[model samples]
Target chain A: MQTESKSPLELEQCLKCSICTAVCPVMNNTDAYPGPKQCGPDAERYRMKDIRFFDESALKKCLNCKRCEVACPHGVKVAELIQTARRDMSQHGPGLREIMLANTDIMGSLATLVAPIANFATGLQLSKEVLHATVGIDHRRTFPKYAGTKFETWYHRHAAQNQGQFKHQVAYFHGCYVNFNYPKLGQDLVHVMNAFGYGVQLLEKEKCCGVALMANNMYNQAKKQGQVNIDSMRKALQGGVETIVTTSSSCTLNMREDYPTMLGIDQKDVKEHLGLAVRFISRLLDEGNVKLVWKEGFKKHVCYHTACHMARLGWNVYTLNILRQIPGLELDILEQNCCGISGTYGFKKENYELSQKIGSTLFNDIEATNAEAVVTECETCKWQIEMSTSLPVINPISLLAEALDLEATQKANIR
Target chain B: MKYNTVIIGGGLTGLVSGIQLQEQGQRVCIISFGQTLLHFSSGSFSGEESNTDVQALLKNAGIATVAGGYRLTPLGELRPAALTLEGYYHSETAELKEKSFAIVRLPKYLGLPIEFLQDTLTAQGREVSIITPDEVVGCPAEVILVPACKAGYDLKKTYGKRVSLIAALPPSIPGQHIHAKLQQYFQKIGGTYINGDKVVRSTLQTDEKGVRVQSVETQNLGDELIVADHYILASGSFQSEGLQSNYDHVWEPVFGVDTNAPEDRTAWTALDFFEDQPYQHIGVLTDEAGHALVEGRPVSNLYPAGHILGALRTDIQNLNDALRIAKNL
Candidate 1:
């Protein structure tokens, strides 16, 4: 057996051009970050010489948005450099705020058990203030409310019985956001897939994709959860699941890219098997094998917000392409800007101000669009945009579910 | 995604061709892998007198340009540049040999060739003077020139209309500016740009129209073949990864288009660094219409533009070639 490597351990490929620095939204908004150049490759050169060369505080300011990686002409894994540095730093056990944010599955389960009480308490202004002072979550931030029913619980009860009747089966990795905060998105994915003649089932075992855990600097926990996710996806693929589609871009990115790079988990076999829902659907549509029937008079002036992870994933085009099919959908794609909410980073009081400042550019763009609602593939961006702007943020899959003709789609895609 | 045109590479040629097609009411998409050679540009463009047609298109996109027969190269010589960014020095390469120039020098911003510039102009039967940026007000030269290095911001803004600038080495801010501007213009005009994504393969169909690319799939979009009625391979040279090589052979990676290079890889380069290498001229073989070829046959809908057009390329006939394709269609 090959000994596992924990980090990407990539060589230094920075050209010292500051191009990454120019694109870094955090550096443009705040001085706390020395920028991606200094934070990633530059710091990496020193980190190799001695452990103390690692500057923890400044590196913590990185949104880990992967914008630097996307902008680098030399293809330097700039974000990987920053993440590996954070992963290697002497393990200070996670703090109270970090623990509360990082333990998504645990917190989500407990919150779902008492979802109404949790939502009420979290939404209450007085309770928000108390939690802000105690737990360090920003009082201005509104936590995405827990659902009355978890997606997995609802999936097993309502959808599981009907899934076996379909010939084509695929597993769905509805992440923590879809599992706890919104089961409606998971149900929508099921409906959209079923309409296309594909049955969506749950993975044999699913865990949080560990995006929040990694952002919280809980790398070890993130690794364990990443391995679990990859293993589950691999097993599902082995069981002849065509692919695993996710409603969350972050979960898809984390599973396909971050797992191998950040956690050093072997996901090559299952990497291509996982993607956002639109990616799979759009591919089939492009090949002219499957057809999606659209509803009549389903009109809405909507704009697509390319979340940072979705941009980094470079799959926003797939989502946008699928959305353009709605006959009356006057689709306007908003300029890509980071929403500054990199997982749980925006909820922390310290980053709350910087996060909002960085996201203001995007919020301003949204305000100018006069769009009825905002569509994005990332749930965190949904939180950030909804909190900052008056627009209700939605997933493309959710919009497609509404726009796709149920009876016509089922008939058209029956072949 | 389906479109009227799908062009690989979002560099100068790709964006220009995309913008031209987009303005003509064709749905266009340009897929770029990493940052293009645009980041390495002088932020200035050089072409022929005929290039003025395409120059006007750039002007509509908020790009400011001036045309002279020639432009000031980084090495302090005049070269024929069809279109020049406003605020950059230019001259008639041979006809206007008498105009004097004032090359501005700033401490710690020693990106310019101070001695070579003065000597070359003096050799060219013209008066050349070295002056500080502050002396631009009283300088006697016809043009106040500065190096396009990152000493500060735009020279024209600081020193007024008399000011001009020359190209710099890689990672020039002005280069990035123009690239960002053109890309923004392309997107603004409803052309979808897929940055940081590369076309990995093509689904080809050959009929009476020749080998047509039915669809082109990208790295990020995997098996999702982006179908287009017409395709353009503006994806740049070996440096930009439009073409790649191993010890065995040199080939175009994206479409496996036919490339012209020395059979022996050993003859690809020169022993000395300064010498022009054979590999530099190596690129995809194209038909008269500039469509890229596969297995020695022209792909009907696949048009090759920019540096991928090989030694025939006249940077530095990029706009002309792109305009040629756009105008033909």
Candidate 2:
């Protein structure tokens, strides 16, 4: 008998059953790239002897959506295996376009500084053509408009002082999307939390969760940012704030799961306290610690889309439970399909066509539902769905804030 | 989160139970880890033998099985199976009475045991000719047989001929279609199905109703409990990780349900390789009404359905037991 015990995700457990290949959205859309089975365990066995055993070119087409991992009955980390190989076999570093897309916090901060000019220039047709030619950002894509006032700026000025009166306090990690593109989601999260008698505080320092960085093969930069985020969580936990929540599904997945596995960041101390806002709040409601009272005569119809990352996190059930609790909300759940805009994957010129093709099934289904709006948890999904379809895609937290009876909830939850 | 019922597995039995419970207006949730073993089948379900609505239930999902009472195996042997994908080869008798047959060799495919099938058919005194897809138009044969994988399901309509398909090995396209349709139908009817998660722990309280499950915890839903009025353990047998084994013991991993495992390792198997083995049939213990047992006491609210209850191997038996249990709950 061997002395060592096997990890649950050992590569030897792969059954070579091709179920991973079936669930891969990338493989189904493109023949240029082999499926997860070929790129992952099938190649890893050969690559164990030498790194050059398999060609690394086809690995680039992977969307890193982690659906293969979700579909594997034996729990093999197919996406992680492919990603680790990319990290190891990569000979060339990220180019200017990748760096621009990967460093989300830096670009977000710069754009928000000159929000009006940045939004106008980014949306201009001539600028799109020039950037598509020079920078390789797809011309057909429109950038997420930067907020005029950042969430941090607004939070410090407006909501920081009044937080001290609440009975319980929790830290918020409003990620780059909330900090730069949409401050309203941050405002909504605060409204939902404050109504539950919980004080929401920002971390002393924060950085982009670096999901985009990792996908772009910028592991070192991702690790650097991941360390910064972990340190802020450590300080927050030291101050007795046990739970730190976020609005973005990708950020939560990056910190909770991908940090130690992909970037080699030790998030052991912080993972337990870190979660999505839906999970934390839904747990509170389940345990009878809080209740949500919606506004009178409120009625809305929305189709909830399961973002790829949200499905990987397995916390979509919590978000769905929260949506189902609304008295007048007519919720229709769309089948879980990858919207094909996996963060920066769909924004590149070469990937532009393939991404839309991969998402066509979802687009058709959403049209069939014809709900008034689309609801989802990931900001990137919101960006993809809203760009592809004519309907507005809003986050679940925003929906809660829209219908929540702030006065009644605040009075009821005064612990 | 709370529901009227929570199912441990999302395979055939668990899904049937969930559908039955939801049809009764009981809010239901099913926690499934990875894909089910339904992917290993060729859309072969066996509930037509029982007085159950399983045939109609599956028909509503657009997965109509052939009406014949037999199925053609990939190895050219005919077996009795109540259900097969609509276009598959199924007949009433074991023998293919057709005088001449053409088996189209699916190029670049190895899932079917073609050589073994040819050898078996030739020994049975049947005229079998292997032909390429290019020769299908000119080939003179009573009927044409084709492998299902790596080929379209609408072979009959596409070729405008007497085409019969057989399921190659898994990943079975026909079976996956069945699962996807049923799962979609389940969700469309308001049943909540949480994918890629498993229940890891359960809290049991002994009240007037002899030990009841108060709540359960899942691997992914950390620190939160899934509270339900009733729970079903349909996590499949050993191959599916419902029951796990170590050096000397076999036990049910979820909820610590009592299992019918031999204590000593020596008693796990028979002398011959093909002989019956104790390990293959090992599973959790449940009372007649399908209430799961712990330490010989039945948990009043916890029911064990499907193959996890042991002594169940056929699709009809699983559906009948799952439906009967769901109705009692």
Q: For candidate 1, give the docking quality class from DockQ.
A: acceptable
Residue pairs in clash, model 1: B47-B82, B314-B317
In model 2, where do residues sit more than 4 Å from their true spots? A240-242, A411-415, B46-51, B60-62, B66-68, B95-151, B154-165, B206-210, B264-278, B310-312
Interface RMSD of each: 4.2, 1.8
Q: What do the candidate models score in CA lDDT, each in turn?
A: 0.82, 0.85
- Chain A only: TM-score per candidate: 0.96, 0.98
lDDT of 1 by residue, A1-415 (tens): 4332233444444567677776788987876789988888887888888989888888889989988877776678888888878887845777899999988889999999999999999999999899799989999998989998999999989999988878899999999999999899999999989988998889888888888888888888888888888888888988988989888988888888888777889888888788988888877777787787888778898889888888888987778668765789887777668998888999999999999999998999899989999999999899889989999988998998899897799888776
Per-residue lDDT of candidate 2, residues A188-304 (tens digit): 999899999999999999999999999999999889989999999999989978699999999999899989988888989889899999998888877898967789999999998
